[model samples]
Target chain A: MTFFEAENVSKNYAGHTALDHVSINVKEQSIFGLLGPNGAGKTTLIRIINQIIGPDTGELRIKGEKLNPDHIAQIGYLPEERGLYKKMKVGEQAMYLARLKGLSKQDAYSRLKKWFEKFEIENWWGKKVEELSKGMAQKVQFIVTVVHEPSLLIFDEPFSGFDPINAELLKQEILKLKDKGATIIFSTHNMSSVEELCDNIALIDKAKVILDGEMQSIKQEYKSNAYELKVRDLQKDINEILPSSFNLKKIRALNNCQSFVVELPGNVTSNELLSQVMPHAQVSSFEEILPTMNEIFIRKVTEAGRSK
Target chain B: MNKIFTILRREYLSRVKKKSFIIMTVLGPILMAALFVVPVYLANVSDREMKVAVLDETGLFYDAFHNSDKVEYENIYMDYATARDQFEELDYDALLHIPESALNNPNSVKLLSTSNIGLNMISDMESVIQKKLEAHRLSLSGIDKKVLEDIEVDVTINTFIYKEGEEKQNYSEISYALGLISGLLIYIFIFLYGAQVMRGVIEEKTSRIVEVIVSSVKPFQLMMGKIVGIALVGLTQFVLWVILTGLIVFTFQTINPDLFKYKSPEQQMIENKGLTPDELAVQQENLELSNDKANSLLEGIRQIQFGNILIMFLFYFIGGYLLYASLFAAIGSAVDNETDTQQFMLPVTIPLILAIISMQVVLNNPDGPVAFWMSIIPFTSPIIMMARIPFNPPVAYWEIGLSLAMLVAGFVFTTWLAARIYRTGILMYGKKASFRELFKWIRF
Candidate 1:
């Protein structure tokens, strides 16, 4: 089910379009990635979802209800530019933000305590935000964003300032949140994290979505007919054994095996290529090579740029 | 409403808990009390004694100079060079050199001092010489100096203000002081509290906390909460200052009862010393005169309608602060930093500064056209009306009512515009917003 949706949303700032006819749906209890280069309207769309800015023309619905101020309580937003009152104590600032997100004072305190303990930052409660390291402050902000347990959580570049260890911790926490039936809208340029965590994605470029679908299906849709085969046969004439539809791109010899990259013509299946290569050499392993999300992102953005 | 309260609570608590706020709150009343009491206390504390050597070449005035606690006079007959030498050797504060020609031209009488002599000392010396000269001239003309001295007259004017059906006493001096004070207080409170609202906005924007808070609460709610919260802070500080200053003043008054007395300390000292019957009678008459002055001052204070003034004061105080604070908040929202605020701040502050500048005119002629128009205009009424209130100006009820209504309308309009600018500006980064951009945000 669609947990949140922005339909044909358009936003203009002083005659400049920030979001132009942009549309995306985030599924329930899943990690939805909002992928875009800088100024690709990703932040604008996220802000629209948070209702920080209203769309000039569009409909925004949360859980099948028209978006209103009432929905603010159900949405958690950690903006791209992370901010906390530097003079405020970490625990107090977190609790204040949690209360602002509609948590009772007692509830905010208890939840924040649990999160602080979970993150092993129980001692930082009394420390001011400015006294904390940037990564520690980011941890505090992350806790503040989720302490209220909003059903739909939006994180814009959530891992930008985190060390690798904390990034792993945050990734685990995000998955934990999704496991607890929370729908997450994760926006970032970090493709590795997207590939590791996101179930669906919408790649926006220049105020428009150029590619969007289930992460697996989008990767599948972008795959060229290519295969990586490991065969222990330098003795065989590999080119003569290969079918006319298969083009051998590169062959490398390992210590015990020869690795070959083969591209098949359209309408040709990997199984047929594997069968054609099986007779002349000992086929030890065979695997399909799909493009990485990074490559796909670059290609899609460049293609959209060219078309523009 | 609950969200607004939440924001207000945070704004208030965070600020009230600040070290700077606490320091200012504690120091403000002490400073105000000092401003009122210190000058009076210092005036009552007598200055150090000064010794003067008078070279009287005209021996006729030798006995005219007498000794007092603050000044001692010694008659010395010597040449100018010898007197100057003796003056330095004796460490005298000054030498009063009366040349032989001084009997013809009094201006030739020169006073030489090692340092800058007090004006009071110079004036006293002049008066003594003038009195003795006058006596000498009168005697030479064969007239009795005592008779001329005794022929003294005192004139007092009893003013009664005639109103609709009754006549009441009027004290212009006391009323003028009250008007000036109340008007000045309003001006100070507005500037103090309005700047607080602006600073609060800039702090939130610069710290980048506005975006996070506004995501949960409307920008309008945030701005209103901040303005009202800082207003409460201002009112709290003002009340504390009033109470503290009153206590300090009362303590000082109790400790030195003569500090605020009408008579100078020298006169009070003379009355305390042994005196002949004639001198005693003169002291008694002076005391009676001071008693009458004190009574009249008390009566003037009693005639003021403090209850009405208090009510109107609070009304205008809040109305004026709200009107100006909204504009200040708008200026704050339209700028990226305090430096950028100057361009917008000038326009908002001009009217308030104008109100203060025009306060004297309002006080001098509370019923004149300038005062009437200034008190009726919403921008200037808060100060001018308070000033005119003490004068019992014939301001119609409808004029005050309309002025207040217009102030309320102005507040609403400015707050709406401020909210529009604030919502757009808080999230905006890097760009220095100009007037044109602010107008566009209002349209947005």
Candidate 2:
């Protein structure tokens, strides 16, 4: 079920179009990756979802209800340029943000305590945000974004300033949030994390969604018909055994096995290719190679730019 | 509404808890109270008695000096050279010598002192000598002094304002002071609190917390929350200043009861005569209606409608603050930092500055064209109207009503325009804001 929906949302700033007829549906209990390049309207779309700025045309709904002020309490957003009041104490700032999200003081305090303890920064509560390291402040920001237990959480460039270990920790916490039934809209230029964490995505380029849908399905759709095969022993030449239609793209010799990649024809199937190669060589392992989200993103964005 | 409250509470508490806020709150009262107490203390400190010795070679001005509370006179039966030689031993503040030709040349009399003698003492001696010389000349002409005194005429003009077919005493000077003071106070408050609002906005914007904040609340709510929050701070500071200043003045009055007394010049002169009660009554009778002018001035103060002035003062202060604070917030949002606000600050501040600069003109002629138009223009009305309100022929009710209505309308219009710019500007980063860009933001 769609937990949040922005339908045909168009936003124009002065003379420039920021978001043009953009639509995004965030499913319940899933991570929706909003991938785009600089000035591609990703932040604008995220802002619309957060209701920070309204779409000039179109409507937004949360849980089948039209988005309104009350919905503000249900949505928590961490923008790319997010920051705490630098002079405010970490714990106090967290409580403030949580209360702003409609949490009671007692609830905010307790939840903040739990989050601080979990992040192992309980001692830094009295410290001002300016006193915190970039990674630490990011952690605090993430905690505040989710402290209210918002059903829909949006984080833009969440892992930009985080080290690898902390990024991993954040990824786990994000997965845990989804497990707890919170839908997240993650906007970033980081494609690797998208592949690892996102279940659904919309690739927006030039104020339009060039690609979107289930992450697995997009990868599946964009995948060229190619497979990597590992042979322990080859009795015949690969080109001689395979049909002319099968194009061998690359080959590498290993210590105990020969690995080669082949592109299948439109009429051919991986299983058929495996069957045809089985008699000719010892096929130890065979698997299809899928396109990474990074490649798909670049190819789609470049194509959109060219088409425009 | 709750969200706005949340934001307001944060904005207020964050600032109110700052060291600077605490410092200003405590220091502002001291500075204001000094304005009330320092002058009174200085005047009392300078009221010391001085003694003068007169050496008259002409022997025509004996017993002519009158001694009051501040100055004492002693006549020395000796030549000017001897008096001048004995001046330090005599311990007189000054030696006043009258030459033989003093009757012909008034400037022939000289005063010699080891230290600087006050101008008051010099003037007193000159007046006493001149009166004695005039009497001497009059006696030579065989004219009676009492007859001459009886013939002296003192004319006084009392301005009466005919309002609503009724005569009312008008104290133009008092009204001018009241109007100027109140107008100046409003001007200060608007600028002081308006800049605070701007700084608060810039802090939020530069720290990049505005986006997070606006995401939770509407930009309008955030802007208003800040404006209202800082206004509360201003009000709190103002109330503390009033109370503290009142306490200081009250304490001073209790400590020195005579310091606050309104002693008229006639009363002081009568007391200086050292006459018995009967003689004082006769002197007061001879003083004529000139003494009534002083009493009537005191009465004019009591007759002034202070309650009306106070109510209007509050209305204008709050109205003016709201009108300007919203614009300050808009400018703050448009800029990246305080330095970047220079371009936008000039336009927003011009009308307020104009109102302040035009206040002098308004006070000079409260009923003139400049006052009338300025009091009606919403941008200038808060100050101009305040200046006109305290005048004798009071500002017309319709004019005040129209000005207030325009002020309210102007506040609404500026707030609308500011909100549009603020909502867009808060989210826009990196680029410096210009007037054209701000106008574009309003359209957005």
Candidate 3:
């Protein structure tokens, strides 16, 4: 069974529909990515899943039962807006947050100390939260959110303030957490991180998912039949001898060699473009160009916008 | 329940442990005492050498406005114009310009000073003029001043209060003390705990911690936990204040032996029973008339019963706090920010202010129609009942019972209303809502 499923979930803020007829399944122990641009309702969907808010329409099921208050104990959410009480000490604040997530005082303290020690922030325990750096405070928030060992963890822009080394450190910790049987929903605009971390992605735009599949499969589905061919070009327009299905997009000539990009139309294969391009110019080498996840994200979103 | 306890412990410890809280708690009484003492000290300090010129045009007040010790009177002023000029030039602290007609009319007195008038100068003028007028009237009636003085005008009436089921009683001192203690307790707790609820709501809402905490617990639980915890904290502080005050006074009483006056000259052989020499000297200097009144007040106090008043004060104090704190919590949740709280705050504060203003009326007329009805009303009962407790009360038991019931009923009803608002309001944002909108949300 899926760990959680949101069926036909809909939410509206005033007259503006934040999410419309959206449905998705999060499987157990998988790192699922929610990829979307700004104002794409990712945070709204995350809030509904966390039960921080209720959907205006539709139902959410946790494990095999309908969602209830007890299910909140199983979900650990880190929202984009980080907040810590400025007047409280870091350690006391962490313990207070942990107890809210269902840990006893002693348990919360022990678990929080372990996390703090792991993050090498033991010396910060006695300091007020306002005294800490942004990254340090975020680390405290991260520890509190995870201290109860929740089954599902949702992080919204979790790596925003960290330097590269600390980002890598947090990345390793995420992987370690997943290995310990936790389902992760990591939402971010950083495509490189998505490429490294996410196994499944649902790209949302305009309050709806425009693309949903495995990361690799979705990337493959959006690839264009374009090729880069290095050739020794004898000057030619290269549009002639090709059917309307094939067109040359770019041509770059070096001292003795040339490189060119080819495009194909409907039902046209990369082989057809390669075969047609070879006759027009002396092709040195040819290869098909698959789109990057960043390109796919941008293209899908822009296409979604244009369609709207 | 355990979650509530955890929340309470966290609230009580962390809040009370703050540097601000500790300093305020420890220094609050000291500051209040300083507030009482500093004015008297400053008055004594700045009044060491007051120089005034007196111009008595009708010769009616030449020596009437006598000056001695710290006050020096110069009789050189001849007219109002000259006095006004010297006053504006800061020649003296003030000029006493008693117009010729003012001494005969008695109500035509006015002080022309450069800067401003003060209470001491007004009282001094009234006392000296009234004494001279009395002496002049006596002399005109062909009576000698010494004969009139020996004739004694003081009236001493013995007031005996007896009840069918109780003994003869004197209630003047007990009533005054009861009103003072009760009014202060109600005033202090309402402010202390009401602000606690406001600060707690603001803290959780501002830190965005309310979002996560609300996921696991209902908004009502969070609100109640904060209110109860802070109530307990207030109670703790009060208990500590009481204990600390008692300890400080005890230390002063047991160690110094110079502070308090004792009534019995016959109990000196009983050792710890009588005043020391300095305390006796101070008591002797307090004058015979005031000492007789003090003895009767002490007798009256011993005749009165305090047991009912203590119970009534506890009930009304807690009940009143719970009622007002609920409203504060509701207001805190409704507006999303403190700036908007003022609009709702005025309604809650009005009743408290009215009750305080009517305290004297309640004390003077406990069984009067106004005090009776106000005491039965829940909002005014906390202070009204306290102020009435000392006046041999004549308070009916049914009134106390009915007031308690109404307060309890009011508390429950308000808690439900506040819970409904808190559940919705804590999550609402952006738009400034109308009362209609807030009421509609309660229904939602």
Candidate 1 collision pairs: none
lDDT tens string, model 1, B1-444?
888888888888888898988898889888988998988776666678988889888777777776767788887778988878777787888889888888778888889888988888789899989988888778888988657856865667868878887888778888789889899999998988898889888888887778778778888888999888888887777777778888988998898888877654336545454455775676577667767877998898998888888788889989899988988888787777888888888888788789889888878888889888888778888999998888753467887898889888878887888888888888887778888999999998
The candidate, 2 or 3, that scores higher on TM-score is 2
Off by over 4 Å in 2: A224-289, B46-48, B78-88, B97-111, B116-153, B264-290
Q: In candidate 3, what are the lDDT values of residues B89-136, reduced to their tens digit? A: 657766776677774687776665566655776786788778777787
Pick by DockQ: 2 or 3, better one = 2
| Residue B261 local lDDT, model 3 | 46
- Which ten contiguous residues of candidate 3 chain B have the minimum total lDDT? B265-274
Better of 2 and 3 by lDDT: 2
Report per-candidate DockQ: 0.62, 0.65, 0.35
Q: Give the clash total for candidate 3.
A: 0
**Residue A108 in model 2: shift from native, Å?**
1.9
Q: What CA RMSD would candidate 1 show?
A: 3.8
lDDT of 2 by residue, A74-179 (tens): 8889889977789999988998888878899999999999999999999999999999998999999999898888899999999999999999999999999999
lDDT of 2: 0.87
Q: Which scores higher on lDDT, 1 or 3? A: 1
Chain B TM-score, all predictions listed:
0.83, 0.89, 0.69
True contacts kept of each: 0.58, 0.83, 0.46
Rank candidates by DockQ, best first.
Answer: 2, 1, 3
In candidate 1, which residue ranges exceed 4 Å CA deviation? A231-260, A275-284, B48-59, B62-69, B72-101, B105-119, B135-160, B173-178, B264-302, B305-310
Interface RMSD of 1: 1.2
